[model samples]
Target: MRPEHLKVLIVDSDANVRELITGWLKADGFHAAAESSGEAAMRRLREEHTDCILAAINLPDMDILELLRQAKLLDPAIEVIMLTSNVADASTVQAMRLGAFDYIVPPLQRESVGLAALKFVKYRNLIDENANLKSGLEAYRKDGDILGRSPTFEQIRHLIADAAATDIPVLITGENGCGKERVARAIHAASSRCSLPMVMVSCSAIPEHRAERELFGSECGAPDGVPYPKRGRLEIAFGGTLFLDHVSALPARIQGELVQALQRQMFRRVGGTLELPVDCRIIAADSADLAALVRTGEFREDLYLLLGAVQIHIPPLRDRREDILLTAEYFLRRICAAMNKNIVDFSEPARQLMQQYHWPGNVRELENAVERAVVVTVSTYIQPMDLPPLQTDPATLPASLSLEELEKRHLLKVLPLMKWNIKKAAEVLGVERTTLYNKIRRYGITRPLRRPSGSVQVPQQ
Candidate 1:
């Protein structure tokens, strides 16, 4: 709602129209600029940050749709309004299809146009606020760099951020490769002990006999052939963080010792009687559900409670499909950088394959796949054949499923990729308009289409 915070660019071939709009916007306390051509408008956009753009649909030198697309590519969150004298159905629909925020017919009324612009700006601000909250939460939860605008991931990020502000031992539970370790690091980074070293001890990594010595220091000349005094992970992590990876793998004896240490803040070194006072924060992660493990008697309940002062559950990548492509792009960039490859983007089929795959191994698998693809891909763009096939098998399908049920699942997976454009979805599926309609009707996939302006309208059945 701060006028200065909102940057608007007005693009029109006619200087008079551009100046008129700019004057009106400036009078209303908005930071507005006017450009006489699409090129000038794009130059301004590139040179400075813009919150939204209002562009004439028919520019002198460039196609309006192309300009709009370029602006969106520059910043996905930037709102764009299309201004044109011709509000034909096709033009309007096409503008909306290309992600224009709103299409305005010329001979613009100052009050009505201003109100509409305000609404668009307000919608954009709400989206930005949600994204900021999500990013903050991701920082707190210690989830690795989050990249998505989806509502679900945003909420998760916010939760992680809130949890990161405390010293309470955090229990992160998720499937393997779900970035649980990244979340632990986020918490450690956000905590007061960030300056101190964070030592990670994988219970599965240490041999059973030496687990105690690994966690607690040992004294010299103590039975193991005059063992020199050595500080354990707990000692090294003093006034810092100790992340226990796969805490459930810890043997019963070590669990008891850890619990005792947590209780007294003191532990006797292995083969020695000296009790060492330790000051450190504990963060534990497990691929399995600790509560379920406790119920099944596979894990100690007291230790679970002690470690799970706060718990964060990360959903699998399949549940948050919105993040898949964003994460893939990030991994692609990283891998390309490492491999010295010029792969800048994925081909259409490659992108579709990525979206269709369920990603059972989660983000880690995606990263590995991208890395492999980067090595194999010879071209600047990665294609479907460059990446490995997904693990979905047709042999696993249910025998009794009707054709309608199968079609619906296929449509559900394809819709997000097409941005929920029914026509585009039909085109991608290689089906006619009426066939797609019948399929939509039969499947009862009646979710309304969402417009770029954040409005929803039901499709005609």
Candidate 2:
């Protein structure tokens, strides 16, 4: 907030007023420039990157409102303080609404001038500091531990940077276990609100009856002995971030209410009359197609539009097979350190098997596999037997195998792993139970029968 870091522009028709302000600014160690008319002020604004402007509202050659408008268009960051002799009420209000930094009256006090300048200088410094931090983050991300070498991942990294620079709501879409929440965290970490709390809510996990209460707090009952006030995620995420995972699963009633709240950036508690301001940035994530849901009337179109101001889609691990071993090694190191093991790396056979396998569960599955291997490894290097069995050999597969056949085969693998519990199987497959059931019907997959001899057999279709 040093004065030497600022460039102040002074505009007034009166030489005395201009000199008076210029002298004060110079004495405070700020670089100052004086202009006698609005025309000259406009010219200076266009040519220089002035941080602040102090202008007389009664400029003889040009309208003060027009000058303010033009100054803003030139540089939206320039803070303008209007000084007017005439006590016109409407013009003052209009100027304030037009983004003037401050309005001052006659007999400008030294303390007032100095204090106003200090406020704006501090604001400028904050802006510069955030820019510097974001720049450093962009550099670190290039070599950071997020773990990817594919072009899709590189584009996603750049998208994270662009989305973090603004306060816009972001909608992240991808298959489950593809790191949607991690991308949301990256946005928040690279933003100005990095130090603030990031409140996360799983839309699909919240019970329908309590959704409203969980999102917007309830007021305390005076004589009912019920808890009077309870803060919701909206209130808790103020001045920070709110991450809505599985947003497409939000109940219909809440979707409508959320649209209104998101539109105005404010909301009322479940039973309160007051409208509370929402100061948090919202980032929503879903594995399903939200647009398709909108077309089917399951999701509100208006809310989707608001949340999708910036959309980021993460590619599933199978699509980025090049990163399989890279990520596997990354997880291997961390898991080994945590488990206090001396495991250094995976053997060539294990590495080959992992690369050959199709990671239906994406990144989360890979991490779990590596953690499992680390727990059982008895030597410095992990062997193929330490990992889970590979799904199938690509060379052994029938040449006519279609995408649908492959999907059916994977679902069959997942169902048995979940012990034929449809709910758990659905979760592991990243699909709704109904969707999983439909796929089972289409593929004619059935649970295997258990024999008294402790053996299982798949029934004939």
Give all TM-scores, in the order shown: 0.55, 0.62
Candidate 2 overall Cα lDDT vs. reference? 0.84
lDDT of 2 by residue, 1-461 (tens): 68997899999999988999899999999999999999999998888889899998879897678888988888888888888655567887888887888877867877878888888888888989989977866754554446788999989889898998999999999998777878888888888887687899998778788888888877786223357688889999999999999998789999999999988888998778899999998999999899999999999999999999999998999889998999998888888889889987899989889998877778877876787789877889999888866667656889899989988988877787667787866666666566687788888886756666665543322
TM accuracy, model 2: 0.62
Model 2, total clashes: 2
Weakest 10 consecutive residues of candidate 2 by summed lDDT: 452-461
What would the per-residue lDDT of candidate 1 be over residues 222-328, giving only the tens digit for each residue? 43665478889999999999999878888899999999999888998888787888798898988878889899988889999899888888788878888889899
- Candidate 1 lDDT at 336 equals 76
